[model samples]
Target: MTATASPTHDAGARAALIAELKRSAPHEAAMRIGLEPPARAAEVLAEMNPAMVQDILEAIDAEARSRIAMAAPRELAAQWSRNAAYAEGTLGRLMDPPFATFRPGSTVGEAIENLKSLVRTAFVTYGYVTDPEGRLLGLVTMRDLLFNDHGTKLSEVMLKDPFALTPDLPVSDAMRLTLNRHFPVYPVKDEAGVLVGLVRGSTMFEEEAFEIAAQPGAMVGIEKEERIATPLFGSFKFRHPWLLINLITAFAAGGVVALFQGTVDKFVILATFLPVLAGQSGNTGCQALAVTVRGITLGDIPPGGASRLMAKEFLLGLLNGAVTGVLTGVAMFVLASSQDSPSAVMLGVVVCLAMMGSCAISGISGAIVPLTLKRLGADPATASSIVVTTATDVASMGLLLGLAAVLIR
Candidate 1:
């Protein structure tokens, strides 16, 4: 079917259009409302008055309510349930409760009679068959119901072993299961196997898109719906802690600085090049760390394949080091030419070597930290950024200062 016209120009125009359209045909209006591009959807939903949402919800039947629910702000559903956490964890929290169902033994005639009393298209389908224990048996399509003899049993023709999930499972998990298996309604059950609800695979997909927009740094894979925000946040949040820890580690490098303090005091020129070496090392290490983190999160590095990944990161570090070292060394040599000291050449060499060593260490740490966190039941995302950033900081100082003490002094 052809799609409906959406408000492409202004928020007020879309809202006005939706309001007028709902008055005449609310279901059509509901579908049209969702069809607007997502940017408009969030903006409209965020700022649009709540009274209008209530009006639209009141005008529609259950099926339409479910559709509207898919697009409605998550906070709206959370309020309906009276618990913000309700929408936080699982697809079951987002599902429309008390959906229509019938026993498997029920005759097609009986099912039709029940369906006839209900509004057409209000329910998902007529073949909504249930097992003896009230578990979903299979969908009985409307076509099948209309053609079959009234007395035919639903169990006789019902598709067995339909797609399903449990209530307590996370929405991320549900989305992954549905996408991988490619089913429509994933029946959700309780611990006792009692069917609580069905998660529409289509709706699940839509919710994920909504989530990706709302949550900062959230990323869902192309192949599955496993939420990867932990790593992003982990990398960002833990970075400070890692920096603090690296501060403690930096003292070791600082001790090296202390050892060379007399030499630096005698030849103050060494102090000028110190920051340059440290800065170059920091830059190289950060570059290597970023690559390692991105690769691990994208699953380009297989789980348990840390060694292989480490080798790759180390190689990248070496390449980055060689190119950056030459440029930085040459730049330092030219910049310090007026110093008239052979120590200037030695300082440049120290920086170049230190940068290469620091980069290699950062790359190896970048790969190892996330893998170690993941293995220990801690989220790798949370820990990777912190560990890598701090490691880079400490390694940067360590390499620069150690080289200064060994060579420049």
Candidate 2:
């Protein structure tokens, strides 16, 4: 059971909520609970109710609706995010606008009264304390409001220059930081240091939960959230280019296979076992690649860590290669070839040698490509899959073909 199981148990209530929101504006209700409009749309959409989808869209602002449209579900809140012209992962995309802000010089009493009056309109997780020019000065939680002396300046009780996220940092990083810190909410700021609005933890978690659901086999055994708020079109853009790169690299392997065409045509016996060697080698390569890429992405691979990573992968590859190679050699010898035939001996040696070589190359290439991309300021996650798989595919094919050429010819 993955963490991404559909929110099926509460399906009925969620459906009713979606229906209610569709008839009304879900955005306003979501704001009270500290959810972005797009996130709200995703939650409602999980019910798979089209009528509710329509109603939600109708209730949201036109701009929000437009952004939601970009997501393909086109609920009203989604459109609002699009229309705001905020780039994906920006504070503008993730925050509720028109949030409350207070002057630093204001009395605690004045600030408290202001919060009380505007509580219905603005989110109260992190009250914005600003200078006259609207530059951020500090933040005040609701607890600060109750405990503070009334005569004190708003600046006194408010957190001075509270921790804030830039509009442009990746949401994944922000979410990780937020989870570790356990802040109820954090402010988002522009380069000029003006407070934009707050990003609530609930919103970040829901968005992350959805994002994790999009990857192949990324479920962590939770329910209620399946997909996350990754930029769908942007992800397509990132993924497509890598796939194209893989396509180009694939030709190298194809060329190697072409080299052994004569050998394959002469001894059809080699052809039958070729797939076994290639498939097993490919699987082993992929295992190493996956582990290395994961370690690198998670920051578990240390600074000046290439040698250590490479050594670990190499040793693992060697072990896997030796085991699989022996099994393959034994199987081929017993099933296909006679003990008296020199060709049987040659074939067995070829499989073992090829397996070892393929595993080593796969491990090395897997660690190298992702680390290189990370150094170049490219996203390691997006590029790692393409690079590692291409290396494994090319290496596996080349090893098998080269072995066939030598042993069969």
Instruction: Report the number of the highest-lDDT candidate.
Output: 2
Best by TM-score: 2
Worst 10 residues of 1 by lDDT: 217-226
Prediction RMSDs, each to the true structure: 10.5, 9.5
lDDT of 2: 0.61
Please give the RMSD of candidate 1 to the true structure.
10.5
- What does candidate 1's lDDT look like per residue over 233-258, in tens digits? 54455345545655666676677667
Computed on alpha carbons, the lDDT of every model, listed in order, comes to 0.58, 0.61
Q: TM-score for every candidate vs. truth? A: 0.60, 0.68
Score candidate 1 by TM-score against the native.
0.60
